[model samples]
Target: MAQAVELPDIQFAAEEAAEIQQNIISVYEGLTGRTLQPADPVRLFLSSLAAIIVQQRVLINQTAKSNLLRYASGIQLDHMGLFQGAERLSASAAITTMQFTLSIPLSFPIAVPQGTRIGVQGGDGSIFFVTEEYLEIPAGGTAGAVSAVCSSPGTTGNGFLPGQLNVLMDQLPFIQSVANLTATTGGAEKESDEAFRERIRTAPDSYSTAGPQGAYEYWAKSTSAAILDVHAFSPGNGKVTIVPLLAGGQIPGQNVLDAVAETLEDRGIRPLTDQVTVTAPTSVPYNTNITYYISRSRVSEVPAIQAAVTSAVAAYQLWQKSKLGRDINPSELIARVMTAGALRVVNAAPVYTALTATQVAQEGMTTINYGGLADD
Candidate 1:
């Protein structure tokens, strides 16, 4: 195999070039017995000319090197999606389950139309929208549950508590109000440039053929950028199980699952004998009870410290969700909590009775209680 040649760094500073020019002039004057003062027109012109030429040369070299690095297989890899042979996935809103209630029982079932805009006041005061329609409110019942997806994608949609979503759309007069029953999960930002690049680089080795497991995994992920990870399993003859995970190892909604199935079906990439099933991963919720002591100096900042710790746990949960089928390391999580400005973590009681190798953390929620000072 031929070794790839590395590009040489050719960047140079304008000031350095100017100093060299000055040194050359000084040598010339000393040898010729002619003094070249700073105020001299010739000296000023020569210095300014040298600076401009040197700066332009440096910029040209930098641009040339950058352009060379952009090419992959002789074609310039511009625009992330184009390089991957797929368009960049747009941002997707987070989806969760929400419950709506009426003040009075109804004799007949009322249909909450689909695309009915229900609003929820987020922790940051932003209003999140729930667009899914609640189709059935049982007769004589005051409440019904419906799936709610965030208006936008990202981590901002994940941490909303049950009562936090309490707004109703204007048209639904029969319904009193609505709130989320579970924290909205599976929200994520658009795929980053580097991530897209890494995926595309593997295209030749993975997605080039259709019958292999890698081909199935590649096509499944290519369906949506929101897809964080994919696991493909062939358990038996003609049975292909495809499990798609969201940003935080949470199970994707029905809509995402349907899309993946539909895309794979249309592609016809799988063998005629194979039976493909697209499904969401099973969710295993992991809750934590943290008991920690705060230093006397940080006692006054207890509230802030607690909030920080909670945020850290949430972040760790999201990270854990990205890798499906990975073990939930309680000790690692405890270490993260210790960094939240707390003096020490006396004990971290993860609700799980025993650690199982097969059980991965799907949804992680933490409840922290301060033990106050060590003496207390």
Candidate 2:
């Protein structure tokens, strides 16, 4: 009998993937002062990537590829070229044109999600959700493509340069995480009520408040140190007051309330209602302090969270060093590095040629159709 050809152990499975993802998210959520939703893996990854860039002071043009990699190591960019063209302005003069291009490759962290066969609507008047099909990736494949264009009037005797238009494309890592989560059929992350409370207690910061009136803003602004503010009143208490601080956008307030309500309800909090009331025009004062006590609960988890982040980086580094890793292409590597997110590949090519001398003059006011030149 022939010996069985054994495949190497894929040590990381769905459970491990989720834990790793959550761990990464914990770092992001802590830094951003934002609550993580069950389906927030992609958003968190993108936000965190942006945060990392911000931290490194990598603003446009001011920074380079190597600098960006300090924050996100999975992808790298190389400037391809800056092409310049010229057109004749006079018998002896020519106009000049310029174009620039860039190429970037993203590597996937794991097996890419094959698109599923999703269902639209049913024949009957009913709703339905169906998987289309699983997405697949070519073995050791690279996804490469470029898109960009620049055009301007030919250069005149007075050198005038148009502003550089930046067209950038970035991958959405959060969507990838969601796809992975969806693929994960049924396996809950393990944590008891006490454990959960402990996690919160050790978090960099935490605070509670009653109602959307203002608790959400307060809690998000406050650091990781748990600060529990138990509100004694509910909506329509006349004591309800929610002033708009960073209004117009939804943050942690509503989500926090939902999380708390779920947890409290689980613990048998009777008919506890959490609601927000937007007062009618000229109804009342529209602003009430609604006194609620905020208490700093704890701050024990910061160290552990930091430690986990370090460990994850090390693990990824080791994996990259392995022989098997060498087989992965840049795109695949980018995909893997930005786990729980979708990869957006960007390619840049010179579309418009630079303006020439004659082209430049033609584009200028040579005819000068003004009153001063109107056969005066």
Candidate 3:
């Protein structure tokens, strides 16, 4: 009888995480041909990235459509109507009209209005939008030249009132923090754990993590943390894996290595060889750089997915012009989809076998939606 066995814990090294993150970011930037905002780029990048994945399938669908068209030939109804009562001397004609719809993302860039005191409203359900008080528009100037003046009510829950103050005093990117000053001014790590914990308890999380007092103390103490990945399995039974920690940004090699180590440490394991390895970095080489990937098993499904996404986006593009649909650009949509797919493939490899349910999900699955009628 087989004994009740325990599944091995999969360790994600800091380095691996960082490496994956960098690759994903590279793909995203390549697709968009623009660097993301420094704050948080992953969510923005992935939200649109899914569209490209579907485009590959769209392409395949289109190819099939073209082939089908060859077999279909008939005089159109409109032309037949005009020729209905005409004599044999009056030649008959036909005109055919096709009906379909496409969907595409409307990418609109929003800039902060002038003198705009910007922040979300309400609580968790709040969304981002601009109001009258937030902006200071100049008379007879382009709408783009407005200045943002972030503000909020003095109530405790007034979302960004205190945040605006913090930004003014410390968080603003334009200003230098204590760490910058320390590195530049030459200061050592200061204070003790007791002091740090006391601050943590009394302070808001952000204030404790990023405020002047926290920054000065943090730098004063020259401490370091290392990440490790431990592999423990029977000989020839081991597996390797890489993960992305922050999935849409420029992550450095050292950061990747550190993140791997962090994961290993969490599992009480250390790297097998006590070192991290990574492939070469990728970047946005041009304006048309799109990246994508899929499981090997799903490769056959790419064409359909591409065609469907493309057709959908194209249909939408046509709708945008007017009730009378305009022609869609199939080629451009296909390119973006293919590029994104290629990128995903470039950075993919199995992490390990005998993994947990969540681990399997993280690696992701390849799904193909092939339910649509082809235009004939």
Candidate 4:
């Protein structure tokens, strides 16, 4: 995986009080032809003036950094993206398929009113879904499924597993049960400054129409802010396959894949000769079985060492699966645990396993066993 964009600390104007005071004293001496020593009254007065100058320079530095992609944020970042016709994405509502079942098959189509509210089991069927077009179960059919959007936008309505939402807020005659068939997904918060800045930096890749690799990457990511990594490659002629990985190593479900596909399949955006396909990456499972010991000299700090080791292991798990095609390297885990003040560390599972560009190494089970205190 490539490193994130990093810009060195930029000083548009010096904000240090000591430096400003020295420069001011030098100018005062040049103008008045006087030696300003530590006991000089004018030098003491210039100290306060230098403090005021420092505040002005702080504002100047902030204004300067706001123009660069690596440092801009909020409205400043938005303005930079406008040069390339890119805009920050707003929060969006999650979506799911609501299945409404009737007690028995009806000779005529049973109406499932548009915007019928189906709440989770505990919410008293608080009508969550926004309005949808009219849908009805076909004649002689006992059930039908229609797409539903969350009334509340953003991730507030996301992550509802199948069947978790089974209560029908609105009572309709002959409706036996109501539940969500698919997991609620696609809800996302507004794009963050870091995510939007990267887009603005890569926005130039979209200028060409020849189906460049960067263009495919930009288009795939533009579909959703949930996407963190995109790998676009061509296995053969005129065929392009793109694999997108979400944040925190969550694999893209069918709904997410469909959304990416739709975004890349636009006729105006896609070339006539190119055939694009969107797919999820394969997941390779790995287990974390670690046993670590603490040094006897650090007995008094045993609690702190154990806490640090736990945090280290958790960080390693996230780093391992954060990117697509990351290898399963137990050595990385050992290094992290050792750095966290462990005297000795042993990992039983997950030897180094190589992965293809389209496969992700996911953790299955984690067992962190402490081996008690030992000699240095």
Evaluated at residue 308, the lDDT of candidate 1 is 87
Candidate maximizing lDDT: 4
Better of 1 and 3 by lDDT: 1
The parts of candidate 2 lying over 4 Å away from their true place are 1-228, 237-254, 272-376
How far is 252's C-alpha from truth in model 4 (Å)? 1.9
lDDT of candidate 3 over 299-343, digit per residue (tens): 666676566544543343332222111122334334444443422
In candidate 1, which residue pairs clash? 94-150, 248-321, 249-321
Each prediction's whole-model lDDT (CA): 0.67, 0.26, 0.28, 0.86
- Return model 2's CA RMSD, one decimal: 34.2
Judged by lDDT against the true structure, how good is candidate 1?
A: 0.67
Q: How well does candidate 2 score on lDDT at residue 73?
A: 21
lDDT of 1 by residue, 1-376 (tens): 1123566654434436857677767876888898888898877876777777677767765556545433322223345346446555666666667777888998988777766666666444365756576567888999888777777666667666667777765567688888777666556677656445545654543444445676777778777677877778787988988888766565666666866887778545767777899877766677766777777766678889888888877776776666667666677667787887777775455543332322347554567777785432
Task: Tell me each candidate's TM-score.
Answer: 0.57, 0.14, 0.18, 0.88
In what order do the candidates fall by TM-score, top score first? Answer: 4, 1, 3, 2
